[model samples]
Target: MALHFRTLLAAAFLLVPATFAVAQDNEPDVDCDNAMTQMDMNICAHRDYETADTELNAVYKKAMDAAREMDVQAKDMGEHYVGAVNALKRAQRAWIGYRDGQCELAGFAARGGSMEPMLVSGCLADLTRKRTAELKTVYESEN
Candidate 1:
């Protein structure tokens, strides 16, 4: 099974470059503003996803802090409130799972093709930006 997995991985690595070469044959230059080749599109989409992920991380930290504060206030009041920090952590984990699955489904649109990476990354970026906005709304409302 391990050998079979390795063989599949090697074949996938080989096929990806061949697919990219087919795309690069038409457009050699990579311009993020006007991504012409599949490789360029993939690179641009990954960059966008990275940017969104960074923004989401920043928002998540702030939300976590807000949750911590709520937990502290509840403790100070001696009230048996559901832990905000725990709830936020649980919700974030679930969101991550959902995002990964949804983006993977989106990649099925161009499965095994040169455009699959671009589709997946685009979906990731869109979802991450929306999640960041949601975190901001949820936490900022308390402030």
Candidate 2:
């Protein structure tokens, strides 16, 4: 299973530059204002996803901290926090699986093409933005 996963990963990387005229290591500095080539578009999309992921991480941390504090207060009151923290951890794990699976499906829509990575990354960014909003709601509710 591990070997299969590694092989799949390698195949995905091979598709990353399959259609791009530019070499993998020579991806030019992207100018989102004017992404002229397919490679540029893919690069820009991946960067956007990275930004979304970073924001999601920040929101998740804040939400988890809030959950922890609520657990502490519940303990002081001789009641449980209803497993809020554990529930969040579990939900997050499930959401991660859903996100990766969704993106992989999207990538397969453009299978063996340079645009596959871009499609996958765009799906990731869109889902991550929604997840960040959901996490913020938990943080707000705890306040």
Candidate 3:
């Protein structure tokens, strides 16, 4: 009886590690991929937004340069033209207003909850990425 009990105890100890390994394997990935808590989700969402915003800024600079070039060409042509730079500035301002308002509306889907921030930030990131692509299309089309 004592030998049988000892055998069972040793088997149980060995199986415990295997069980834990399987459980861990089934778990979510690290960092944002494993963001199970609301706080972590919010943080990941904000980080995503920040990355998108940075990309947008870079593309916006290139777009602004392109617009300025267009303005110069129009001026050299001696034709009255709506300034490309000015128009781009106006459009960007309007887009910013729209993005903010639209994100706020998205947050209302989770209103007053911990997930509100995540929803808003996710929306912001998505919109910013789309806007970045649009800017690239407009300014870097030749490339």
Candidate 4:
């Protein structure tokens, strides 16, 4: 039993990075290949890239609003408020890249599937939900 557990853990450890690498290898190419027409393809690619951009912007705005609220709670909290807001902004930007990359990867999965648009949309929704949770954490921590 002990050996079986150890083997399983080792296998999981090794598989994690390999899975990540395979996912990374698949994302951009999948998005690139899914376009049925040149225009539609370009649009699909743009939409995939923009998903993160839009989510990041929304997170930034939410963070800023939270910071402002915090500022109103205590005047001397400016520096801390600003710092949290800035951190959230930076995180948001990074999240945008993460979201886009993940979505691109998901797009690859959709390539051979019949419901590509639905798959892509689901990916975007999941990413958005994640970003919202991140923003909420930042907001709650500052308060």
Candidate 5:
């Protein structure tokens, strides 16, 4: 009877660790894949936003360059090339305003919480990616 009790105790100890190991396996490693910890998540969110912002900057430059070329061609028809480029600049400025206000609104979901910045950054990343695609489309169709 004592031997049986000892065996049960040994099995229980082994079971606990095995279960814990399995649970840990499901969690992402902090090396590259995003870990769910707040710090890691926040870092990952900012990284994503930075990448999106970088892409947006590149596309914006290309689109602006296309506008300049279009304006140059329009000059032959006695139409000012500066007009179209100026219009695009105005649109881009308005977009910047909209993006800021929209992200601020999203941050409200986590207002006063530690995750507010993450929420705002994530929203910015999403919107920036979409805007990059839109700019690319316009640039493509124009040229």
Candidate 6:
């Protein structure tokens, strides 16, 4: 059981980069209208992306830790299983792509509108919540 958990945890960690890459790639290019204000806009945009990325990274780390705990438990149970690790990795990658696309689409509702930032932020929050639920389900099932 423990070994199984470790395998799952390792898999989850390995999968995080792909998700992060997708999220980063799909991030909208923030425009700066004036050279004088370019630094400020860049800073604000960077801060926003960093905040969102940090939250998402935290979720991934938590999932990985849970997987590790599950692995330890499985090893203790003497099951000696090694199933679904690759599947989990693939699923995680798919999920990242899904999240990026979904969030980008969500942002379109307020394109060129004053609420664009709000729309995008809301979309990100929604995705984070959904992803959290998915991870919870995976962790619960392992138990």
Q: Estimate the TM-score of every prediction.
A: 0.77, 0.77, 0.76, 0.46, 0.74, 0.48
Q: Flag the better candidate by TM-score, 1 or 4.
A: 1
Candidate 1 TM-score over all chains jointly = 0.77
> What value does the lDDT take at residue 7 in candidate 6?
100
lDDT of 5 by residue, 50-113 (tens): 9999999999999998888888878888874347688889989999999999999999999988
The candidate 6 region of ten consecutive residues with least summed lDDT is: 32-41
lDDT score of residue 110 within candidate 1: 94
The local lDDT score (0 to 100) that residue 135 gets in candidate 5 is 88
> Tens-digit lDDT track for model 2 on 39-102?
8889898989999999999999999998888788788667654577998999999999999999
Higher-lDDT candidate of 3 and 6? 3
Model 6 residue 61 CA deviation in Å? 2.3
RMSD of 3: 14.6
- The true-structure Cα RMSD of candidate 2 reads 8.0
Most lDDT-accurate candidate: 1
Between candidates 1 and 6, the TM-score winner? 1
lDDT of 4 at 11: 97
Model 4 stretches astray by more than 4 angstroms: 1-60, 68-82, 112-114, 141-143
> What overall lDDT goes with each candidate model?
0.91, 0.89, 0.90, 0.68, 0.86, 0.66
Candidate 1 per-residue lDDT, tens place, 20-94, comes to 988957654567999777788898998899999999999999999998888887897676784888988999999
> How many collisions per candidate?
0, 0, 0, 1, 0, 9
lDDT leaderboard ranking: 1, 3, 2, 5, 4, 6
Q: What is the lDDT of residue 84 in candidate 6?
A: 39
In TM-score terms, candidate 6 sits at 0.48
Q: Model 3, range 1-112, lDDT digits (tens) per residue?
A: 9999999999999999999999957654439988889988998898899999999999999999998888887887775773889888988999999999999999999999
> Which of 2 and 3 is ahead in lDDT?
3
